[model samples]
Target: MSHPDPWRTATLGNGYAASVCVTPDGDTVLWLLAHGGCIEVDDDYGCCCTDCAPHEQLNRPIPHTMRSALDRPIQPRCSRPRSDGQPCRTPVARDGLACHWHRTTKETAR
Candidate 1:
């Protein structure tokens, strides 16, 4: 019997959603959302629930034709200011206020 595809069945409802999908390049990724915001977690971590086993097996890569539909045109930029007092041009890390460099610097300073 063929296994069910998680990406096809994943739904957004009740202010929470989660899914495992494959990129066009064959990399598997997990997307999660809660409370109207995206939930970002470390790459090494995963859901501990027993129900995740079946969904995790569905890693069929997305088609290239679907890339544009999935891509975000406007992403949040880093909020840190440059040396000349201009806003940093780098994109912010997923669900973060600053880019990787600035985020690390800020965390180390605290």
Candidate 2:
């Protein structure tokens, strides 16, 4: 199953929202403005600016990071049924459909 994206656009106290995330190394921060702008900054003044692009033309990758924050998937709820026959309210395993208990039982039976 596919999971939601960890990085999300947040409203900056106004009608505007932007996707923000930090690099895995925690040295750089990147954000894409919903108003056709992009911002990137590092510790020093090496990279810092708010570049305004045309509508839907903000296609640029964050630099100096091993993995893109957008590539990481968000946590997903389990699809199993609970004791009351309701959907499970817990998150699923990282690489499996069910949660730890459900997946473990099914795997052990095999």
Candidate 3:
């Protein structure tokens, strides 16, 4: 007999079937069926398992607006100007509104 793949969908003791996989840290994650045939991942968030991995697992559906926000283009240009008096075209910091050089210079000046 051929062994079944652990990631394959299996009967979960109901009409529901889900694919379960173990993460690198050994957390049992289940891709369960939600409403309207949408698949949702169950990372045992409601369970009392103490050894559950700290990494976030998708268990809820994200709104279309929020999902689109992730796909929105990031045009992070530096706020400072160049030596010719034109606006800087360098990319800004991911964590802040300023670019790397401007942020460091401002910090050192304080």
Per-model TM-score versus the true fold: 0.27, 0.25, 0.25
In candidate 3, what are the lDDT values of residues 35-88, reduced to their tens digit? 343444444433222123222235645555667888898876775755687766
Clashing pairs for predicted structure model 1, backbone only:
none
lDDT-best of 1 and 3: 1
| 4-110 per-residue lDDT for model 2 (tens digits) | 12456566765445444554454434443444333433333222333432222235545423245556777777756666878666775553477766665544221
lDDT of each: 0.53, 0.47, 0.51
lDDT of 1 by residue, 1-110 (tens): 12224655366777766656455456666656445343433455444222333333345554445556678467767757666878776875444477776765644221
Q: What is the C-alpha RMSD of each candidate to the true structure, in Å?
A: 14.8, 16.0, 13.3
Per-residue error (Å), model 3, residue 61? 32
List ranges where model 2 is wrong by over 4 Å.
1-74, 93-96, 106-110
- Cα displacement (angstroms), candidate 2, residue 89, comes to 1.7
Looking at model 3, residue 21 earns an lDDT score of 51
Q: Where does the lowest 10-residue lDDT sum fall in candidate 3?
A: 47-56
